[model samples]
Target: MSKQPIYLAFSTQKGGAGKTALTVLVASYLHYVKGYDVAVIDCDYPQHSIAEMRDRDLKLALEDDHYKRMAYEQFTRLDKKAYPVIESSTEKAIDDADRITEQADFDIVFFDLPGTVNNPSVIKALTNMDYIFAPISADRLVLESTLRYMVVINDVIKKTGVTTIKGTYMVWNMVDGREKSELYGVYEQVIAELGFEVVKTFIPNSLRFRRELTETHKGVFRSTLFPPERSQLKGSNIDALADEILELIKLNGNG
Candidate 1:
């Protein structure tokens, strides 16, 4: 771990942009695959998708053999322990994230924020983030919303005056191979000008990503159902994404 109590969030003003899915992906990777302490705050207000997903996962993990074996293998790889993931609202997520880190000795905390910034509570929650990642598709509407969201996060950085976000990254999701259209390059150029990074490890356009994940609560990518190593996702895949994230933490210097 670069430093303790690191806080990062997955956010975008657009719904269904893979915030919760990627949140689980990264958190599970850190905890099970890399053997670091991690937790997640599902602060998506009305939806609380993370919490609901956890419940569904528990159901299937108990009933399904593959999920049960996956959980068993993860614990066996580690020391037979579980990481903590809590659901909180904006008003309490910041404090709770810190409290859990301190008390539980968590290396990183992930926040799965709501899809809209219209809520003031949600806006306030960004002040606690040390880094923020936004997953975006190649669609025009999503790009527009993502651009507006980046501006809002930049504004929050200035307004807070406390280095709320050390870096902002846009994750290219559902990408149709590296052979993107001209539109994709243009968006990357614009985002680079805004001082944000486009993560190199892109998730390929695959129904595997769209697979209903309730059956594998221990993880989606790390689970045996969709092994990252053999899957057609990308190099390092989620594992590489996790490594890049750790490198990012080194760049942030205790953020």
Candidate 2:
């Protein structure tokens, strides 16, 4: 039987919207926590943040003992399983994806697409995906770009009969629940009116995410320097979001 891998395409026509960050987080969680053999396709050519982050983390793991220890401890608490293997590929064609899928032996393949709808290669890649996750922040410009991308995806689905596009979702990244942000209500209303699914979990704006990049060579962070309280809480939140995403996948019969 042919191996059917779960294809997740992360795209938004808006950069600096946490697309790469969330892609790495989800790929890490699935590999470390769920024990899935995952591979990341870096479709975003110029700024391959996902690939860069993975490379930095790997180098730190090899050179810094303290960082390695910290990373091991964190992974232990999160999954106690094998660490996810992340790699970079700049394949811009459907045939290229098929070749990668055949050779990588991955159960889940994620495409880190560029933040634009005009790329023909990206559109070709999206055609082969089982899930298209568009992360949108509570910003006017970002929202406008994301909505335009969604419209393009809708048209593609209509033309190609690929139901895998599922729907566009607004992930409340860098969100502060305490304050009443005007864009939050407006975006939520717009999403609902357009019949899109809004993920229940929100990724709050915190320094912890930025700190995840600064661990020692051993993947260990200095507990005294950066207390574990916030990291632990953020880890829990990420775990919840992963679960919610999995639920969405299952609901669409893709998981």
Candidate 3:
């Protein structure tokens, strides 16, 4: 039997909350490292960040000997093509994803949706997701905005029982190592009061998280075509994050 493709997004209503970053990393991790069939629907229209990155990655891999050789070795070993990134709008995202699956079966199709829920089409797409992982930070404004967003998603969308959404989780991103433990404890209590679960793996704040395919950088930390090199990923907690997401999906009986 063909398994149903899981639809997921790393989302929050707050801008600069690391939604797009997490989407690319986790999608790459699942596709390259874990050997899952993955595809990305870049629905953050006008930007199409992931799609653009894919283009940049391809160009760099062609021009730079370091990246070119790495790509060659990876493709030779894995014998799998880089997962496709489809440029789409929020209104047509679900339809585009459905069409992609019909062409090539994917284990998961990640959507990089816009950071606002004001539009009905965006809400409609959210309702179609099997899971949504909202990345939160230690900042006061980020926390407040994220909590508010989760309330709407939980009370308005998931509770309707008319949607495919199984869970909406909180993932701690860009965490400062020097922050007091008490602060996070209080935040956790608030999150629990709001009735949302957080992913166990907290991503530490690091410059490596911001690294992209660049002309000067010899090592790749983030790419749409390949997983972050193991050395670059050392302290990011992304591998653990991906594993936890899969476990949660399985617990929900979708894996």
Candidate 4:
């Protein structure tokens, strides 16, 4: 039987839309909670953000005894062996992905794509993915770029006949709930008109995210790390968001 792997691509034609952050969160969640043997392909050449984060996490893990123990425990529970993120692009990255799927025995592969649509390598990477998650902010430029990315991917799907595009998801990241922003409403309407599925969960603009990056810990987002000064995202909200994403994968049965 062929091993079916979940291929998720975090993509957009705009930078600074929390692509890398979302990628890390998803992979970390899968590795720690879902117990998936995950591999990451850092296809964002010239600036491999995913690779950097992984390296940082590794270094932190090595220095911190508690983190090391946690990582070791997670690996022991995984059905498949652990593999590090592969950093490559162009012909080489494509070749590596094929090899990794065949040999490494991963259950899922996350591709951290660059924020530009024109790169041939990026298009090739997208063609291989089961789903594309496009993170969008309330900024006009980012919204325009996200739409452009969707169009580009749609074109590629039509051309390559890769039916795994599934659909595009617009996640509201770095949102502030206290303030009402007109740009948020405008972007939502635009996305609705464009026929994209907007994810209901909004990742609040919190310092916890930055702390996660520095601490290099997994599942911090899963728990309420602090009170008052660091308000945790509602448990129901996180659970619903996770369920929606998982349901997308289950419904398609492609990822």
Q: Residue-wise lDDT of candidate 3 within 215-254, one digit each (tens)?
A: 8864677899789988988888998899999998883223
TM-score quality measure for candidate 1? 0.84
lDDT of 2 at 150: 79
**TM-score for all predictions?**
0.84, 0.78, 0.95, 0.80
Q: Which stretches of candidate 1 lie over 4 Å from their true place?
A: 1-3, 159-163, 212-236, 251-255
lDDT of 4 by residue, 153-250 (tens): 77656456865666667787777764537877777887788777787776667655554523544344521111111134343133345557777777
Best-to-worst TM-score order? 3, 1, 4, 2
Error of 4 at 11 (Å): 0.6
Global CA lDDT computed for model 3 = 0.89
Q: Tens-digit lDDT track for model 2 on 78-141?
A: 5543333334333553555566677656667778887666766666677777787777777778
- Please give the clash total of every predicted structure, in order: 1, 11, 0, 0
For model 1, name the residue pairs that clash: 236-240
Predicted structure with the largest TM-score when compared to the true one: 3
- Assess candidate 4 and give its lDDT: 0.65
Q: Which stretches of candidate 3 lie over 4 Å from their true place?
A: 178-180, 251-255
Residue by residue across 147-194, what tens digits does model 1's lDDT show? 888887778554568656677888988777655678788889987887
Q: Candidate 2: misplaced stretches above 4 Å? A: 1-3, 69-96, 162-164, 178-183, 215-230, 233-236, 251-255
- Highest lDDT against the true fold, candidate: 3
All-Cα superposition RMSD per candidate:
3.7, 4.8, 2.0, 4.6
